[model samples]
Target: MQTITVEPLAQEHIQILRLTSTPHLSGGLDTIAPYSVWITYRLNTGANQHTWTAAVSGYRVLRNGVTDMDAASIVLTNLADQDTTPDWLTDLIAKYTPSW
Candidate 1:
């Protein structure tokens, strides 16, 4: 007879672990465009952690490279759709900004 062992399922926690953005330059110039934001967030789940990226210009969001509309709506609502930029994103941009 063979013995088998099984591990318990990991707890699920859907939270944003990290957020990053890449600003696109306008026509290869130094100017950044509002619509050229590409936001990527790490969705942390104990055993199913993954990253999602969204294009603010096209309103397209993807999870692990596949289209996820529900996440898209959530990302847009909390990030781009707001009247003002989210503080977290603003801070991230600031961190990357060079002070001269």
Candidate 2:
């Protein structure tokens, strides 16, 4: 079973400052243990075709007491400036790559 929960750490009008993810639990990616799960959502509202601004957005690998996979401090850039990925996020992606 896999689950992802989002909690607003800080909000400002239509722009959220610090959005965080709850403890994500999964059986592992394709039978692997201790894997990272990262999820992304669209910020565009389809009603009138408008997009909201988010100052921060990312996933944190929840563990018992390990900061090695924790991404709570990572802040994502805007969509246009997202060409370069953050080192921390990249690390988690590599660590959790499905081996199956």
Candidate 3:
């Protein structure tokens, strides 16, 4: 079983967790004409949180997992600034698997 943990930098803000729910195209004419991936944003606004029950398609998915972090970062260029990398992400991982 694989998973990820996250936290917000500030107290007033919210933290969220989201993962791909489906497989989609890499790059093809049909894929270019209309994006083929599906993303579900689960928002956690402090005391409130919700999951996307119905897939809201159109974004691309990085299937290579961690090795494709760079590519995944590109897919979410708009939100890349919010990524918890190197330090923060490391802390999150440690909390989950301290022995590792």
User: Which 10-residue span in candidate 3 carries the lowest summed lDDT?
Assistant: 69-78
In order, the Cα lDDT scores of the candidates are 0.37, 0.33, 0.29
TM per prediction: 0.23, 0.22, 0.18
Off by over 4 Å in 1: 1-83
Q: Considering only N, C-alpha and C atoms within 3 Å, which residue pairs clash in candidate 2?
A: none
Please report, as a residue range, the 10-residue window in candidate 1 with the lowest summed lDDT.
Answer: 24-33
Error of 3 at 27 (Å): 10
* Candidate 3 vs. true structure, TM-score: 0.18
Over 4 Å off, model 2? 1-83
State the local distance difference test value for candidate 2.
0.33
lDDT of 2 at 33: 21
Best by TM-score: 1
Q: By TM-score, is 1 or 2 better?
A: 1
